[model samples]
Target: MARRVPRPAGAGAWGRSMGQGLLRKSKIGDNKSTQVDLWGGACMVRQVENVLLVLEYFAERRAPATVAEMTDHFGWPRSSAFNIVSTLAERGYLYEPRARGAYYPTPRWLTMAQAVSEADPVPAALTRVLDRLVDETGETAWIARASGLHVVMLDVRESPQMLRYVARPGMRLPIHVTGSGQALMARMATAEREALLKRIRYQAYNRNSPMEAETVRQQIADSEERGWFMSNSAFSSDLAGVALPIRIDGHAYAVTTAGPENRFVPRMPEIAAAIRGAVAAECGAGALDMTPLRAEA
Candidate 1:
């Protein structure tokens, strides 16, 4: 028989030690010894933030800026700043004339913004109507659109009085609480109104706020009977308001005027007439095609 070769001394122990070291290293990950360079550690996209910062800097300056000026202002390295400026110039957003020249934002940005602004129909139509309504009523006039179970004030023209009700654009109110909400419900079809009524959460905001469904339904019926809707201390104890429903391009909207209760309640009829006249003048008689509730009766 062949002689058995003797195994190397401590070879098994050495192999075990090497295996354990590898396992420990894998568990700890590469965070300890690896000095990751600037672009290698995090895989997040920071280019968007850099681009926005460049645009904002240009906007604040309102004049052309060279790459060196931008680097100094932003504390960025010269190479990084140059790359950002070059990329922006390559795109249509920035324009430069010479090889080493100042960069300016192109008219493309302004033209895009103007196009977006003009595309929105609400601002153009409601602005003209609210201006005249404010002049005629001398109270805060506003336009509100229905958003789910809430009414959002899209625009407002504040009253020129020392103690007038104040409302800001983008203020959201419960659909069951405000005069605009009631007018919107009144203008809806019967089936749709009933469906929406079920979704409303009836909470008593104040003593005057209608908390019961039956009471709210009665108020909606009353609003439908009249061409407009009114509320006195219903939303706030010291506030009163009147609202008229308007239809534009098959969308339902409400125009409202509100002020301190003592001043607004007495002039409800005048405010209602002013809103109607303003709508007629701005939108034309075709908008008045919605039959008045009394005519149906």
Candidate 2:
């Protein structure tokens, strides 16, 4: 050890404080850099990639995987494994048996994954048309894709109104009550329609009318004959909507417009034409050019 020397008299006391501060800052800087390097290994993008890989494996194997299995496979903490599994199960991509400690991919997961994997062209075309409908109508528009025993709202564009509608993407509405539901059901083969109707649960509240299975069937038939579906105070007392089916490449997609009932019913023909034009453009046609005024007669 070196011998300590006495400080010179009149040395600036502030200089001594500055020297001590510098030494403390150097120690803190080193510790902070080490911490960042350690935690940076679990970046969000890498975490998502790992989750996707795990899902793909589950899809391929069609087997239940436990949190312990995920932890061991992904080298992730137990909490992360549990979170991923629970979220996937809640989203209907995975099924978790009560107290089973394992999860299996559901049929829904397989269907959606297959659709995305196939790069279905119909959806891409339908999206363009939905966008134009929103632009032309200035009311919220939606594209609903049919799923097993249900119709899922695939996408929705909001109206620029301060008080707009409440449809959301990925929201599932029962197939027996909504205009989008009726439009698609009307196009389904007779056998399929009957099978689906059997499983539906009709929701009716006080003073709200409920449709019987037969009534639902008749409404669907009328929608097909008229080439459009329209309702005033159906879903809500003040809201009205009109919908048309976009039949492309044998796939049925629906477009719907909703707004205040007073505005919607008076201009029902205009709104219907906007939706039809949007659908026609999606099919790569010149223009719909067909006025609802003529079609209504």
Candidate 3:
């Protein structure tokens, strides 16, 4: 821990590379890492890891935890657990609602988390686009951004239809097969996209799913030509999706409308048009791009 120092104002790729490495070396692989804590146990910084795990425990247990409970939960010595919990209590992150009672996290934790998330919250215009897609197409709509080889749904608007693709924020979808994933990849530089494509583990989510990088590359290529993306690809075998890539401050994100194939497939062209119109109307013409997203090397 003493060996590394903080990155300065102009940190280079080493900083970016370190962050990417943490995401890439997930014990659960590229897909599940973000779905869990942003980088939790995967972070080599041990002290921080313990704190996140403690918070997650409180979250899961949904009950105030005594020091003894913490001890038993983490298998730490009573003194070690007491010290950790005590430190958090002193810092106002944890407290006993009743004296001599179990310790519970304070609102400070939630407020601070909210502050951080809101600092770079999803664009408001994108929210409008998602709502528009739901209104126009009457299907589940989600906005996702590429996270490693998966696209993490940042927000979701469920369809009113009885048989729709029920999705939620924080759902992770395979990068190679999802329409949101394909649109996101299409916005990346060719070399970067190729590198990610090569690393993809193309599972046969369905008999028609692409099984190779070339196939996916061609999909992106076709998407670049079509100006939007659509797929029968699914997290559930019977679902289908349409996605359009948009860039916000140079970051790639996709807004998608998805549902059961029986209903969604027949309306693919209409849905894609709706998505494109919504993006153009709510996000402005500049928000959509066909030029590759290139980060400074």
Candidate 4:
């Protein structure tokens, strides 16, 4: 079970009082500093945190958590914990399987998550492909789509290992530096790719990163020929990743596998093979069509 952070006395009241004021200020500023403020003053959203933490605790443990358990883990007052849990129960996000017993998250959360995933352009047909890749390779797998000058992770299936690379869904990476970025670039038309390259401000994120346009273009060509892109310590010294382009409905997407360098480097071929096999089995030859996105008029 994951341990929770401790809260000081009167923290709940302080959180409730400050939360309203902070919410008002956040709407006005709406800047980068607002994120810092929210994280730094997380105590102000203690009630919200309590609800999320309870849900996470249930997920990690695969069991229900009682009010007392939540109170002890978060160091929250018993009454505060009870109120938060009770509110969630009332909201249908959680349910008590037994009277005065532990609480568990309901299917409502999963349903909403599935709905959100379906709303993305990647299509639901690829979910099993990502899941199979993770199962076979024991590494994180993701589907990313190019968005302007950055590649955004549309969906992700995390590795089950205790120590693994985990990038959150919707996380963005530069188009000029990441393996997924290169894979996506490889599938685009020469003119479109060049246009995007010119717009990119290529700065090295690590010693291995290709900061020059010529070197990046060569890498993209290599990936185009090999049908996959691989990078070790390019974006982050401790991480390595492999990606392959998958085209769906004329949009380019990259399926990627990432993990700590020590584990990912040696298993590169195995990971690549797993991804190829998953894509072939799930999507078939029709899915390999790499038609470039038509330039918007």
State which candidate has the highest TM-score.
3
Q: Clashes in model 4: which pairs?
A: none
TM-score of each: 0.59, 0.55, 0.67, 0.62
lDDT by residue for model 4 (185-244), tens: 877778988998887776656678888889999988877677678887776567889988
Candidate 2 local lDDT, 173-226, one digit each (tens): 556666777777766667777887887755441122245788788777777677
Off by over 4 Å in 1: 1-119, 291-297
Tell me model 1's lDDT, rounded to 2 decimals. Answer: 0.68
Cα shift from native, residue 33, model 1 (Å): 52
lDDT of 3 by residue, 1-297 (tens): 112222111111111111111111222111132222222123367667567667866764667888887777666788878878889999999999877759999999999989987997999998998899898899878899988888888987877765556555665667778788899888888788889888777656565689888888888788778767878743445678889888888788988998777887999889989988999998888887767788622
C-alpha lDDT of residue 37 in model 1: 19
Q: Which model is ahead, 1 or 4, in terms of lDDT?
A: 4
Model 4 CA lDDT for position 79: 94
Residue 158 in model 4: lDDT: 73
Q: After superposition, how far is residue 14 of candidate 2 from its true place, in Å?
A: 56
Clashing pairs in 1: none
For model 1, what is the alpha-carbon lDDT of residue 133?
Answer: 85
> How far in Å is the alpha carbon of 162 misplaced in model 4?
1.7
Best candidate according to lDDT: 3
Q: Give all candidate RMSDs, comma-separated.
A: 22.8, 21.9, 10.3, 10.9
Cα deviation at 50, candidate 2, in Å, is: 20
